[model samples]
Target: MIEVKQLTKRYGGTTAVKDLTFTVDPGQVTGFLGPNGSGKSTTLRMILGLHEPTSGTVTVEGRPFRSRPRGLRHVGSLLDAQEVHGGRSAVAHLSALARSNRIPRRRVDEVLERVGLAEVAGRRIGGFSLGMKQRLGIAAALLGDAPVLLFDEPLNGLDPEGVKWVRDLFRGLAAEGRTVFVSSHLMSEMEHTADQLIVIGRGELIAAESLEEFSARGTRQSVMVGTPDTEILRDLLAAEGAAVRADGRLLTVTGLSAARVGEIALVHRVPLHHLSTRSGSLEEAFMELTADSVQYLAGEPR
Candidate 1:
């Protein structure tokens, strides 16, 4: 388990993380989410002892990570996949890390194969593609076989198959009761991978809760009704005080449940061609929650 208490970090006059308090429990995949410039990377660095907090504390298994001897054996992290010696072969890199950390050399081969890099284990880091580098980074992290793992943007350069493999890998690690924490700006990926979510914005805590709970904060449930009698259905729904809008053949109805909408249509002899309820998507909820926290905007707004 990992615990952070009132954790804060600063760089001169800038604050990267605020008084954030949260816990990452084992046996679950926790997704760390935020918009650009939200300090997700900085917080991960603090947890790994790479960045010292300006105030407060972060501890792994009840103690500071920096206080641990052979600390790499307690927690493994992949902060930057490219932060490796370009001249070293994958085997050479893992071997050196193992030797210095007192880890057995055999685990090096085991992890290389586990991450599907066994065929390229002897290849130089300089020639690897971005996806291959990510695999190598994951292999390095697994070399320690630590109980806690931290990954920032692990899927940045993965193909569809690689992405699926990574999603399964995270779930498998959590199944073994390890604390698996991943940070990414991709909500669609998180929707399928994470069991829990910790969202932040502008270096401050926005929410910390189960994925279900976080998605529950989305806009009220709305139903899409399609009918040949658009004109009649619209008038009837509006008469019931439900907000209704027409988009092509679909009538997007809000402020009423599916049953209510269907009942109203039937009462008026309206023929229904289609009807389905759509609670806002995870992406929708995330945007609604973090709209104000987004640090930048694209081209001119509509």
Candidate 2:
């Protein structure tokens, strides 16, 4: 488990992270999300002690990360996928880390096979593609066989297949009672991967909740009706206290379900051409939630 309490960091005139607080628990994948320059990387760095916070603290397993005995054995992290030496073979690279940490040399091979990089164990990292490097980074993270894992943008350069592989891998890890904390800018990608989300914007914590709950808060069950008798249907629905928006041939109705909308049309005797419920995409809900606090907002029209 990892806990960040009122964490804050500043760089002279600019604040990189602000009083952020969140807890990552075991047995689930917690997704961290924000736009670029939103201080996501800065927060991760602070958690791992790579960046000293101006205030607040981060702890791993109930104690400060630095003070925890055999801390790396409790937490495995992949902040950068290209941290390995280009000249070194994959096997040799892992071997060096394992030996330095007094980890069994067998773990190197085990994790190499685990990440499906066993065949390329002898290949130099310089010859590997971005996806291959990402896998290698994952292999290194698992080399410790730690209970907690933190990955920042592990899907950045991966192909679709690789993305799914990583997604499944994270779920598998959490299923085995490990704590998986992953960060990414793609909301759609994290939609199914993470059970909970910790969202931040403008260097501050915005919202943290279960994925389903978060989406539900931003939207509700609504139905869209399309018919030629738009004027009549709108009047009927409006009289029933349903919020209606008419956009060309489509009418968006809120505060009513699909079945209710159908019943309303039947009662009013309005000929309905098409009626269906419209569900909001998780990405849309996320964008709307962080719109005001987004750090890199587009310029307004002149």
lDDT of each: 0.92, 0.88
* lDDT by residue for model 1 (137-211), tens: 998888899999999999979999999999999999999999999998788899999999999998999999999
lDDT of 1 at 252: 94
Cα deviation of 96 in candidate 2 (Å)? 1.1
Best by lDDT: 1
Candidate 1 residue pairs in backbone clash: none
For model 2, the stretches where C-alpha displacement exceeds 4 angstroms are: 68-71, 224-260, 267-278, 299-302
In order, what is each prediction's RMSD in angstroms?
A: 2.4, 3.3
Candidate 2, overall lDDT? 0.88
Give the per-residue lDDT of model 2 (tens digit) for 59-114.
87777767755555778889998887999999999898888767899999999998
Query: Model 1 RMSD to the real structure?
Result: 2.4
